[model samples]
Target: MTDGEIPVICSGKGCRAPARWRLVWNNPRIHTPDREKVWTACDEHREPLAHHLAVRSFLRRVEALD
Candidate 1:
């Protein structure tokens, strides 16, 4: 995969699409805030994923993953 390519399909349950976004996130209770990695998401699922992560304050950033 390229630097910004989605290595897998969208992680959202019951959905499958070539991911278009990389959501860098970590849970402070289990990992340091600085400890983060990318999660692939399709456009339709982007907001839901982001909202889920944001509600728990686990989101670091969202970026295009080509």
Candidate 2:
């Protein structure tokens, strides 16, 4: 998507803000590390989402969408 384009909402519980960060992740146990892609989280929910993903060791990297 283009810059400033509203991203898919955070997949976290009850979060509804437009995503601002794109998190690239992959589950090595289930798939090869080469299979990676992005998930979005809004500014307000970014930290929580990142923390949750990190706790599961699912986060590979994160970048601002715009």
Output the number of the TM-score-best candidate.
Answer: 1
lDDT score for candidate 2 against the true structure: 0.80
Candidate 1's TM-score reads: 0.81
Give per-candidate clash totals.
0, 0
How much is 4 displaced in model 1, in angstroms? 17
Clash pairs of candidate 2? Answer: none
Which ten-residue region of model 1 has the weakest summed lDDT? 31-40
Residue range 1-66, candidate 1, lDDT tens digits: 769864679989988788889998999899866788677799999999999999998889999975
Pairs of colliding residues, candidate 1: none
lDDT per residue as tens, model 2, 3-64: 99655787667887777788888878897878986778888777877887799999999898
Report the error of model 2 at residue 38, Å.
Answer: 2.3
CA lDDT for candidate 1: 0.86
Q: Which runs in model 1 stand beyond 4 Å of their true positions?
A: 1-7
State the displacement of the C-alpha of residue 45, model 1, in Å, after optimal TM-score superposition.
Answer: 0.1
